[model samples]
Target: MSNVLAIAGVTRILKDMLNDALVFGNVDQVMGTDFAVTAQPPDRIVSDNPDTQTPHLNLFLHRVTPNAALRNADLPTRSGDGALQMRPTLALDLHYILTAVAAEELHAEVLLGYAMQLFHEMPVVPRESIRTSLSAAELAGLGSGLPDFGTGPLSPAELADQIEMLKITPVALSMDDMSKMWTALQASYRTTVAYDVSVVLIERALPVRPTLPVLTRGGLRDPETGRDPGVAAEPHLATSVPSLLSVAAQDQHPVMRLGGRVVLTGTGLDTGDAQVRFREAGTDVSLLLVPEAPARPDRLVVQLPGPAALPGGSSLAGTPQDPASWRVGAYEIEVILTDSEARTAATNRLPLALAPAISATAVAGGLARR
Candidate 1:
């Protein structure tokens, strides 16, 4: 990006661009060293003062407006070092009036035409092409560029290497507006055109630390629910969890039998991204019962896995008796939201029983009932 250039620097850059236009436009002979630049109130152009009665292009700054998008953004250093200093860069849109002056109509029209052509062909000024200062000898060769005659020091251009390309767009003014403008300037209107130069940025000079990137994210959260990480037992708080209302089979009989679809109804279950847990009662062998299906706020349609399909089946768990495995047993149903960084809360444990209606086996007594 380019370093901050003051208003004077901007004026210098514009003058150079216009000067180059006349030189390379092959109209050097026509617009010779006689070309002039006057103050905004170009009364000199019509004055008896010989300095004003020359072939010239008058550049006047008409307006300056702030760039809206660049306004009010936080500074990079504000977040660092706990500093409240907000050193924001000011982006400005510059409007300029380029008017051609000459006693002859053709000469004035030709100069204005060349200026328009130059800006049209090179709408954006590149970094390398910007110049801070041009020597008297160089100006003499260009047929333009007046030497600094004011008592003040010479203001040099400093807009080189700015990140944004200086874009020039033509302004369309209404007839009444244009007339009022010329009258307001108190100068006779000549062949003139308006151009807007954008994104002239001036950065703050305050001492600030460089903006740093976020290195890490804190805490663990279940991305699905934006809730706390699932835990083995309880929630972080007792009051915040989804309160389990009821879990019932969707069938007409409404029996919570294994392998049947059941709807878990709850109060706080509406929080997006939660889980319904069917934990084996009286054991630490808890498995995530909620399927990878979508979660709802008030209810969840889930299919209970059969005993054989229960997480870590009894047969595979141990030889004879796997106390933790699901079988003909009682379980606790819970709705949980694990917002790790925030909190982990689960509804009160609700009791659920898994039962087989009837089982027959050929035993010593032909059938076994136990």
Candidate 2:
């Protein structure tokens, strides 16, 4: 839950930690010279005048990789139109190489040993240590050795407030990898050790669209009946389960048009008080149609309402002036069966393409009537 500055904050904290340890642990006093801690690249550490260069410990961030455990934790965080649906976080792991430099013999090795020991003794960086190391000179002591009196432009205090603690562990590099890394740097190899810092979470600060809590599990109960018809117990059987094979127009046309009859071919379709349900795709609108009398077990016929009301009663109808209730698009067709005892079950849903009926046509500079 930190900001983008967390990565730089980590490097700054490590540099300060080493600087403090060297000064307070009396390593510089025993060596009779000051030991400097830097976060510069290994190639940049090389200087022409080695005698003037003091004993130094450099922390170079070599590579950054995604944390495997929480890499995809924030998937599907955006909507179809690319609007923010939820807050997204980036989890990362940082790899660094700690190298020591000195002109005198054995000084570089001693510095490297101290740096490794400091990390080993404190495997996990404490929140208090981070806050203190990144604090300003007025808040901390003047000896606090960081750019701009400890609080740089990176705003590293955000790192201390993160939820996950930073862990430092040693990484074993193969000789081939070491050789390639040095060759890439093009600098003389010094006493170096690799360390891994993990779980730096950088989150985006943006408004998210949150859904309202559900007030009811299903539809509201009837005022008089005190029961919800939306609840039903559907039967699941290994054999003789109601399923739809195909739904096509009466003339075997692939598309169904207004004022046309469609035949439903399936098994176990005939049941108590059965009706065909049409659900428009991508919408909650539904239309129900009653089957013809003397229903067949494996087939049923339903007539779509025309511009005028049909002879037999139908659930819905469309007119030339008003066709709002009927939309020409794809729909899901399913058979709903309800018994006398109010027990209801539905068959599998299949796709149904509803086509618009063209009764008249008008073109530019001309008009035609059908």
User: Each model's number of backbone clashes?
Assistant: 10, 0
Which lDDT tens digits does candidate 1 get at residues 1-370? 3334444556566677776677666575765545654434455556566345667776778888987776555456365567746666777888888887776557778877877887898888776565533333444465434554222243223456556667888898778978988898787777678888887877645776566785444447557977644444545554444687787667744346655666787766755456667776777655455534676666777665544432554454542123234456677877767663455677787776666545456788577864
Predictions in order: lDDT:
0.64, 0.80
Clashing pairs in 2: none
lDDT string for model 2 (192-296, tens) is: 799999889898677898799755544456679887656445576433567778899997788897778888888777766888998999999888888777788
Clashes of 2: 0
TM-score on alpha carbons, each prediction: 0.53, 0.54
User: On a 0 to 1 TM-score scale, where does candidate 2 land against the true structure?
Assistant: 0.54
Question: With candidate 1 superimposed using the best TM-score fit, by how many Å does residue 54's alpha carbon deviate from the native?
Answer: 1.5
Question: Which portions of model 2 miss their true places by more than 4 Å?
Answer: 136-154, 211-370
Give the runs in model 1 whose Cα sits over 4 Å from its true position: 1-4, 30-33, 37-40, 49-52, 75-86, 131-158, 209-305, 308-370
Candidate 1: residue 290 lDDT (0-100)? 58
Q: How far is each candidate from the true structure, as Cα RMSD in Å?
A: 13.8, 13.3
